[model samples]
Target: MSNATPPGWYPDASAPGTDRWWDGTAWTAHTRPAAQAPQAFGPPEPFTAASGDATTAARSGTRIAALAVAGLMVVGAAVTGAVLLGRDDDPARPEAGPSGSAPPSTTATATPSPDGSPAGNDPEVLVDQLNGITLPIPDGWEKPDRTVEPVPTMRTVDPYECPGSSSDFCYHATVTSRTASATDITSAEQLARQDITAAADRAYEKNIVGNRIHGGITSHDQLDSAPVSVAGRAGYQVRWRVNTAKGPGGYVQSLVFPSTVGSESLIIVRYAFDAGPDGPPLSLMDTLTKGIRPIGDSATSGGVGSSIAP
Candidate 1:
């Protein structure tokens, strides 16, 4: 007996129209006219192999074009990155510190102290000899006398004050010492007026040490103050201007000495040529005052002697 076919079997194209083929769960094969098949579906065209040379050429051209475009992009990115980095590294940019916006600090150099010596060449010493002394004599200024007889003293080689050519006034050094009580001592106001009159009275056509002029004690009231310390004694400096026969004159004289029982005050007088003109440098006065030292024990042991020269 022939084998029976199952339901849903269809004819197979490979076996021809009379033969049947088994279909699993559904019809697996079918045939239609060429026109009808075309209307519904068509056979795929055969794929032909391309020439190796043509294919390789086209692929190489595409790859080269892609690589060129990629290279330009990379170069552009690199250039941009370099430019940005350079700007960040520029030195002119503000630097960051612990205090977010603070700028860098700078150090300042210290100034040297002025030389404190009799001749401006010796190191300053803290001796008990002279205290709060000052002088303005130029370096190597001649000191005729260096020894202290009865008082700590300093003298300049050249007379600092001289009479002007147009006036009868003469320049001289006036040394005055008073052993009276502070009450007896002239007030600072009185002393200043006295100094100006003294300068005018002592004025001569030529400078002299002690040539006196005849005149009443007229007062030229002008006064200013400065801080001073002498031999551990605190005091103030008094300065003023006065008119003399020579013209308007300038003067700076200070009396700073210890005010104790035996303490003595010394006044070194400096007179200028005229107002508005350069006068004797006050530096000399500074040097003289700084060089002032107490007389040795032997000199002041029996109370300050009276050998002090004005």
Candidate 2:
């Protein structure tokens, strides 16, 4: 061999068997190839069964328990429905349910006659009777003038002056008579004013005209500026415009007291027509004023009290 060492040979640098051989450029001879551990094997011990069967049993039990609960709920609902139906069908109960307990049967009561007087058999006859009193019903108007006989002691007549005309449609002239006390007699003038004001309030549905009370008489007029008079009473003559099912017009009401008895009398004349171009007819007002008379003669005639009648 020549003096140069071989290119691939190298001395081992480890003790004995542990010595590593080198292949010149690196120590490749010292490295061992990696090996994987072998897996243990046998007749797979008893092939342990999956817990799937026990899990299925538990799941099936849960489903059955849920179904049982649902069934019990359905049964409870049916029981409640049956109980309700049974109660509804029970014969002991009246057709009305328990909440609608039957009221005690009561005998029908007859309506008592008004003012302890019998009702009129004939409305026309009643109207005629009413017309015979104080106020005269205008002719050519409806016959058997409307009568509201609420009480035997009270009668109200609605006499229209002219039913066809809207402008002058006057309601029935009314005459009311009733026994009253001395107090009623004492306050006749006040009552008259009150009645007039009430009527005007109803007619206009507005403020009462300014007025003055003089000589036991309270007089009301329009704005205290207009010139009007009633029954020579030296005041504005007030007219009330009234609208009704029959039509619309004006009403002139007067209150008078009986000369003999301490009682009250009322007269209402309804003038139906458009307010005349010259205003209400002086003739109508004159007639109405002149017509008011107390039941008895005047005090000058040796009567106990003075009559308001003309």
Candidate 3:
């Protein structure tokens, strides 16, 4: 008898508890109650040759096909909605992450001179204010036309020298916050994980080839998820890295917190940096995160800080 499970009756991959007919090569729409199906679904396809080499090759092909399907499923789940950063791509392909290449030399130096105080110092300020929240724009950084879902605000640090070279690309930094439905969401950590997972799944679907066995995440790693406090509320944070269609990209860091007024309102902060080795120093991310504050919570707002650190 062939090792292959003969077609006739098999559990449907898509629907649980329902039996579907497998005509050896593909599944048929025919269905019947699982309990009512006979033990034998159908006879296995006969081997054309009895030689050992032929049987081995046949089994190898089947295994390879199965592996391909498994890979596709994993990639599909991870890449969905990950490219929420921007929509600069062929509509047929997944959207690539935000591109922060230095504008034409005529635009301005990658790093501009500070307006006043050094970057990350002046706290009484706000950049790209929205949703009753604000960010502390560091010195030498400039607001650019970059936005992503859930209300994105982008600030770029110019003169950011690219890795291993003297050249620089406008380093892109973005902060976005959005409220998600709390229905069935038990904890803030869960919310953060869900969002990150969704982003990854979206990215994978768009970038990875549908052919499962041959395509998947180029490379990826995720840091441990941790608990955090945001605006006096319990929250969670998660970080991960993966190679994207454009290049290496991932959520440098993300936070999710919840508030209760009438119903549960989950707030999320997603911080993304796309410049790689030429990217802004990680310390800058710390400064901005510490400086974020909900509007109307402070008496005197912070002063505008210089983008260029003096």
The most accurate candidate by lDDT is 3
Q: Least accurate stretch of 10 residues (summed lDDT) in model 2?
A: 98-107
Please provide TM-scores, in order, for all candidate models, with all chains considered together.
0.32, 0.29, 0.44
Please give the lDDT score at residue 19 for candidate 3. Answer: 48
**What's the lDDT for residue 92 in model 1?**
21
Candidate 2 wrong stretches, greater than 4 Å: 1-133, 141-185, 202-252, 259-282, 293-310
Q: Count the backbone clashes (under 3 Å) in each candidate.
A: 25, 17, 32
Off by over 4 Å in 3: 1-131, 144-150, 157-171, 200-217, 245-251, 259-264, 299-310
lDDT of 3 by residue, 1-310 (tens): 2234322344433455554443334433344444442332122222222333422322332111111122234744743222123322221121111111111111212221121111213343443221234555666555444322324344554534322223323244545555564356767887788787654543332312222210224665786588876656677887666555444454456677754221235666766555366446656655665555554455425323344241
Rank by TM-score (best first): 3, 1, 2
**For residues 72-151, what per-residue lDDT tens digits would candidate 1 score against the true structure?**
45744743222112222322221111111100111012111121122323212211221223322333222232332222
Q: How well does candidate 2 score on lDDT at residue 168?
A: 35
lDDT of 2 by residue, 161-200 (tens): 3433333323333333322222333343444444555544
Model 1 C-alpha RMSD to native: 48.2
Cα error, candidate 1, residue 116 (Å): 22
